[model samples]
Target chain A: MAKILIVDDSRTSRRMLRAILEEMGHEVVAEAVNGEDGFVKYKELNPDLVTLDITMPVLDGIQALSLIKKHDPEAKAVMITAAGQRDKMIKAVKYGAAEFITKPYEKEVVEKILKEVLAL
Target chain B: MIANIIANYLINKGKISLDQYYEFFEELSKVRAKLGLIAVHEGLMTEYQADTVNMLQATMDMKFGDLAVEKGFLTHNQVQELLRKQADPYLSVAQVLENMGIMRLNDLDLLMKKYQVENEMSSSSIEALKSDEIDRIVPLFLPPEADEYVAFATLAFKTLMRCADNNIFPIKGFFAEKLDCQNGALQFVDGDPCLTAGMCGDGNALLGAACKFGQEEFESVNMDALDAIAELLNCICGLYASELSQKRITMELYPPQYDDTIEGVGEYKTLIFPMMLGDKLVNLLICIGEKLEFRYS
Candidate 1:
């Protein structure tokens, strides 16, 4: 089971991701409200996987992802987005985000994506 | 929604007693049948066919008539005919009233005429409302500038019916400077001109939607309830954004935010679409080109 960190402004999204990850036998080690806090948490926890939300108040997922990758090039980060964020998704991919998940998360799809990312 | 509106109008106009209205609604509920069942009864499709369509409906998000047509069990025209034969809620109430000898057919007709006149509804608009077609009825309530958002409102209402509450109906929408509510969820869409959409209601209405969305019972509109509602709003905004993107409009969806103590007036111009979900009242607030601010009461 992989150690995961969830970074999103939405409490609901974090709670839901935690539930899904825990149900799949993965450990959710930490959570952050936005990209800025997320970067600090990533450095402190050094989790195996990180999920970052794109649109946020203090800092955004892409900027945080870039910073994390700069700190550790092998950082496995998955970008979370709502639909119609294709442009941001492309940017995240270019910045070394390992995977993507959309909002109103589907359990099976999320599990499959997480398994794939963790396996890598 | 139409039935409730008509019933309220009748009660207010002294055309029907409140007790009689309740009794009439009770009878109307019993007699009102689904389009699939009506199709079967009208001999347009076999019972097996109707059952097959219903089963497909359970597994798929498509409507019964659309699935039936796709499966070659009924034509588009036949589906329309079946839908016409299905007892409309307004007509069902009127028939119950007539059957109970509480109001004659002529009196019911007169009341309907008065309703249209007082409501300033054209015959076709009244027919559309009676048919309970959200697409047709939504535009009638929107201002000319806000008419562009009718598609979004229609999709929202349809999603509510499919996922949250099937018995909901919309009230007339109006343009306002601000809408004050106790609890609500809001999300912003970034694009050429940003749009803000949110749903707000009192604790009861918020709880009602949250319970339906979460499929869990909640005592009040707490964080969990607000989360469920915010998630629902997120879904709606995502879909709306996707629709806009298809038309070559680039939009970005922000995570949904919820505020429980939101009250007071805002400076942004908003279109307030009020709807009734079961017994609860909820409002969808839309603002285009400006950020929304709330004032607490």
Candidate 2:
């Protein structure tokens, strides 16, 4: 299990993700509401994995992902989103997002992705 | 109804075990709870009324809401309102299964038509009646299992009919502060004690329903139903808050959270209440302090 950071605007999503990750024996090191806070938390906690939501106030996921990569270069960040953000998702891939997960998550899929991202 | 048909078909074809069917049914129950909560939030009726109807429907051949109306508990307009408040379940499910283009609309339509015939509604008079007319005729389908999927599917079907029948957008989403008034509350995980705080949302005809419903039936609020209900509250909050904020309320909303079973003892009373949805009781726990202590049942 890997240490994880969850960044999302929705409390429900964050809690759900925390449950799934913790259930799999991974530790959720920290969480942030927006990409800006996420970036700050990223610098402070430096957890093994980060799940960043693409659409957020202050700073969006792509921007935070860029900032994290700037500092760590090897930051393993996953972009999370709901439907209709296809363009932004494509951009995250280009910016080296470790993976992307959609909203209304499936536990198994999330567990598998975390394991895959942590392996690297 | 469709699920049972599909499950039966699968059973006959030797595709799944009976145990799998039971598990699916259980999950579907959660979904139904979610839908019932949404309907209540939409101001269709009170949680107790919905619960009463759900229980009555169990032993009798009657529409859940219809039973309530017959008992003089809810007005026809209220039943119509509840029916109108429903959203499309197939669309929700489809959104969840974005990758699988498995079920076609036409196929589902045929299944529905077949279902209509199987129940022996062959009279041209019944067929000619409008969709809403048919809906009033059969309020609840009472499948072998009342699950989340079934509830969602039922809501979707009703929503479509309502849209087609009424030609109106029943509700729209917006974020504002009057909606954000502390008047709207969060139910905590602890025992029956509630916090009387302002909630974020648009204060409208709906506020009366939210306040009354929140206060009436639930001691420990139902989370799944609350999430669905809160989505409307959020929309109402968004619209109401936008007007109050002058600037849009920039704060983001977290998804709905819930826990059915909790055990503890404390004087720092927590505010979470239980609201009725159909036959199920759902709880909503308000998170105010820095951390929430919880254990799931």
Candidate 3:
């Protein structure tokens, strides 16, 4: 099971992600409210995986992923976004994000992506 | 949505009893048929052909008739013929009422005329509502000045139906200075011109949506339920933002926020569309071109 960190401004998204991760036997090590906090938590907790939301206050998922990758080039980060943020998703990929998941999280897809990201 | 609006209006106007209204819908539901089914019954297409078109519809966003033509199962003229034969929801309600001996055909016709005159609706507008096309029907409910937001409203309603509940029925919308609710989720679009939109309700207005979207059942409206509501609003805004992106318009969406208190937000005028979910009332709130501030009591 992978140790995960969730960074999203929505409490609902965080809670839902936590429940899904826990149900799948993954350990949720920490949670952050936005991109800046996510960058901080990534350095402190150094989780095996991080799920970052693309649209957030302070800093966005792309910036946070860049910072996390800079600190640990081997860090695995999955970007979370709503359906439309293609431009942001492209930027996230350039920053070395391992995978991406859309909002209104589907359990099966989440599991499949998580498994693939953890294996990588 | 139009059916619900007319039924509610008739009930309130004393033209029809609440019991009669419920009975009418119940009977109508039993007889209401889908387009594919109608096409098959009319022998325009075989059952297997209709089934194939239905399956395609689940994956594609196109209408059944359009898909049928695309699949080469029917031509444009045949599809149009089938559409003409498709039952109009309002007419179905009237037919059910007559069939059930609730009202005579002549009396129902007079009542329909009265409804049109009382609501100041043109027959063409009524026909648009009967068509059940979201794009066409949403404008009739919203103020003409807010025409630019019709696309946003249409997307929001379609998303609500697709993700939350399909049984929702929308009522006419109006411009208002303030709206009060027990709980709500708000999000803002920031860019060339700012926009703010939200959904709010009293009691269990959002409870069913929360349960459906979250796939969890809660006895009451709580933080978890509100979270589901916020997620839904996020999805709606995300879609609207995507549509804007296609037009080369860039807009940033703020993370959704929610509150439980009833408050009046500052001077911006809001377009409020009230919708019925089962037995509860929920309102879709939209404000354009200005930021809003709320006054808490």
Candidate 4:
């Protein structure tokens, strides 16, 4: 199992993603509220993977993912999106998001994405 | 219907045990049972009419639609519509599998069509449900299950996962004439079929969920908290409407409203799906064919 950092504005989403990550036997190293917070946590925690929610109040997921990737070009990211956020999804892919997951969360898809991303 | 045909074919070829055969049909009937409830809920038949037909089914060896029609409970056209519901088993299951990101779209559709062709079942009926002809977000058979009244479970589960802690679990859905709610938010799913969807709760549970959703600690369940819940509902409902649009169904979403004044929510046949968000309980209500009425509105 790998370590993970969850970044989303909604506390509810963070809890849910944490629950799923932990259930998959991955350690949740840290959690952050927004993109800036997420980037800071990413550098501090140095987890194997970071899951980012695309929309946030301050400094959204894309900006955060970009910051982390700039800091460490090898950084792996998974973008979380609501359906029909195709434009944001394309941007996430451009910024080097390893994969994408859509909400509301489906456990099986989350597991598969993690497995493929971490190769574990 | 596709599931049964394949299961029977495999059993006849000695591929699966007779035990597996019975298990398959037992599970198949569970899916079919929801059709009867949906028929009643859709006003295609009365509860008494559905029940009498179900009772006759055991002794008569007749199909459900034929039996209902023979008893003068439904017209031939109504039975055809019900058959459309029967044709949806594979597509319903496929939607779940697709949502899980495990299967390609139309894989199950093609597979079921092949099975229907082999069994000499009506392929046109299957296509009718899948065609531009039927355009609704919630199909005759819904995802996670076939019952329309219970279909909100998927949305409720998603809402809680997005706005509340993941430890929350849903209680089985049931028909409630009225619900006592101190704080509530509701929005109408207008157009095509007039309906209402809302969230209602009081005390710790609603407040806790609202706090997480809003990222704030609230002392009581107020309009602010209700507004947060309403916003979550609105977001998902918009996505749901978007999905329906792809199917060519036009739906109207009204502005979500929250009220602390209503003592209760009721009117029409309200389908309530209760959930335990940690230690507190909240209810997700959906009223089909009519708008929800608030007590003391």
Candidate 5:
């Protein structure tokens, strides 16, 4: 299983993601509430995967992803978006997000994406 | 101003501490009550019935109107009227000015009519006003797109109040009802061990209220509960759609439809999931693209 770092501002969302990732046998290395912390965590823990939520306060997922990639060109990050955020998702993809997810999660779809990203 | 009035009233009556008053005021600002009150005033239910339910809601683990309706104290139509009666008390320009000690009642009355004309509000809508509950009406005014989630949930919660014995106020968002279950959707938030699935069959959206919240207590079987469940579906969709605004994919919600039989099955798996809200049992189902069925808490 891949080591993962979760980032988002909502306590509820963070709690939910931690439980699911742990259940899937993935090690949750760290968590951050926004993009700045996410960058710091990525630099420190260097987890195999980072799940970055886009609409957080301070720096957002896009900025965080770019910073992480700049630090390590091969860094893998997954972008989390709300439903109508298609525009942001495209931008994240261009910045080299490994994959994408939507909120109010669906388990299998998440696992499938995680597996796919890990394989890559 | 309404928040201040509520806080002041509660404080003067010694019902809430100063700190609690501030907290309640903050909470009141976040709470949306307009649409639910409109539902009540539009011949939905009697003021007494809604008040009684609202009172019952505050103390016991009981819902407001649902208990009254179940006891045969009020009809569905009456309850719906009561919902409309719960309109925003703060938005009445005259009342706001009067309450602030700036205007007299007669002057306020004349202003109400003129303001109504300027805003194109019907006389009937004005007549539907219940002066005592104005605080409840103003907050429901969200941008148009945001109204879908609020309307669906408000309606669902009102229905639950009319039907159940429990009371739970919505605390967070009127999350839009639409969702995009793209890969890795579950990584953002966590709660409950859940089965994941999806379906793509044509389904109906709810009518009447803005948002819906579903809770099942002790497996009590009520056929009408199906309507409640459907309303919850609408809330989920609205929240999902709202979250996707950043992606620029706008989703239009279709009205809810209902038929008697459960005849068709699709490629998606079906699982019954549970969500815990205090003592409430929240059963949720996830369907993807008309194929897989999954349980979600």
Candidate 6:
């Protein structure tokens, strides 16, 4: 089981992630609405993993990922993207994002990638 | 669309074997409605006139409509009307079934007449509906075996109305093989119960949904506007997936496809629910059990 933080601008996304994580026996330590809030939550929660949506009103995912990595190089992070955001995936990788999950994501794939990141 | 109805009836009556049924649609898939036939069908021209125009095109380098216009057999407006009718799936299916000798044209017409009469129920039901009563309107458009999708479709209509246009309204849904539109977005869910959903429109029809949901005034429907449309689909898919997940039916979204000139081809029947958004029309299409080949664009 892992301690996870989900940060997304969409309420739907936050709730869905929380449900999936809880069902998988992992604990969702916190949920944040955007990247700036996500960064603040990471500092406070010190969770095992964080999932950040790539776009948000304040301090988008890539920017927040940079801050989280600088704060903890070993942080396990997954970046959520919609289509046409493939170009940004390369940038997220450079910023040390562990994996990428696109929207309308399948459960098996998301679980596999997140587990792989946790194992690392 | 009529083909499926007749096909199902034939199966239930044991008029055709299962193998024959599959073979019929296999042949039906090869059928494409031609302009000359449609012109004759619409009584805009005679069989003799269409034949003459086809022969003239062999000696000249012009489109059928253009040559027909040159020959004064059809006006330019009439040709444009024929071109639009060329995409009609009903005509294609009827032509194929007639050529295959499976059913007589007269019998097919009678079946269609009966189908249309039964279908008047939904249209007459619509007349009783008050404006702002979309909840009562949504179910009338869904196809059979769509109970799971009722809430999904309802939320989609509500979201588009609240976030994009206040006065958007959906017409009755019908089956079509394909839809041609200027631009749009679509996403799919793959799980125990698969699903496909999409929206598209021509010209400035989609501009309202794009700008209002995006919260940006796009002068025209551009890439930025399309991206916003994709995001809106993602948002809807996310909500739907969550609801289904609670039922122990896990669902996940495939990437949303969007761009200029989306062409969707449904493997089965594609149900299109037309909506009046702004001054133009936008289409909402949903298919169950299989991915439309983009199995739709």
Give the number of the best model, judged by TM-score: 3
Top-DockQ candidate index: 1
> What lDDT does candidate 5 reach at residue A19?
81
lDDT of 5 by residue, B13-115 (tens): 5655766645554454455453223333344545465556667767777556567777576677766765654445543322333333444334545655764
- TM-scores for the candidates: 0.74, 0.39, 0.78, 0.44, 0.37, 0.45
CA deviation > 4 Å runs, candidate 5: B1-297
Error in Å for residue B200 of model 3: 2.5
Inter-residue clash pairs, candidate 1: B263-B295, B263-B296, B264-B295, B264-B296
Per-residue lDDT tens digits for candidate 5, residues A1-120, read: 889999876544566678888999999998897899999989999899999987765788899999999999898888876554556678899999989887656678889999999998
- Tens-place lDDT digits, model 6, residues B1-297: 234445655665676778777777787788876677778768888878988998998999899999999899999999989888766665676567666777644466565555446655443443323222556667766666566567867878877777677656565667676777767777776777687888787766788887777656888877667767767877677667666656666665665667765554456656777766644688887777777654333
lDDT of 3 by residue, B166-248 (tens): 76777778888888777778788787788888888887778998888877896667767877888899899888888889998
Question: Which ten-residue region of model 6 chain B has the weakest summed lDDT?
Answer: B123-132
- lDDT, each prediction: 0.81, 0.49, 0.80, 0.68, 0.50, 0.73
Model 6 sits at an interface RMSD, in angstroms, of 10.3
Q: Which window of 10 residues has the lowest lDDT sum in candidate 3 chain B?
A: B97-106
**Compared to the true structure, candidate 4 yields what TM-score?**
0.44
Judged by DockQ cut-offs, the docking class of candidate 3 is acceptable
lDDT of 4 by residue, B41-86 (tens): 3578776777788798889988888888788888888877766765
Interface RMSD of each: 1.9, 8.7, 1.9, 6.0, 9.4, 10.3
Candidate numbers sorted by DockQ from highest down: 1, 3, 5, 4, 6, 2
User: DockQ of every model listed?
Assistant: 0.52, 0.03, 0.48, 0.08, 0.09, 0.04
The lDDT, on a scale of 0 to 1, for candidate 3 is 0.80
Error of 5 at B128 (Å): 18
lDDT of 1 by residue, B145-221 (tens): 77667888887888787768866767778888877778888888878789888888876687888888766687998
Which runs in model 3 stand beyond 4 Å of their true positions?
A: A22-25, B6-30, B33-88, B91-101, B104-109, B218-223
Report the TM-score of chain B alone for all candidates.
Answer: 0.73, 0.21, 0.74, 0.50, 0.24, 0.54
Evaluated on chain A only, model 3 obtains a TM-score of: 0.98
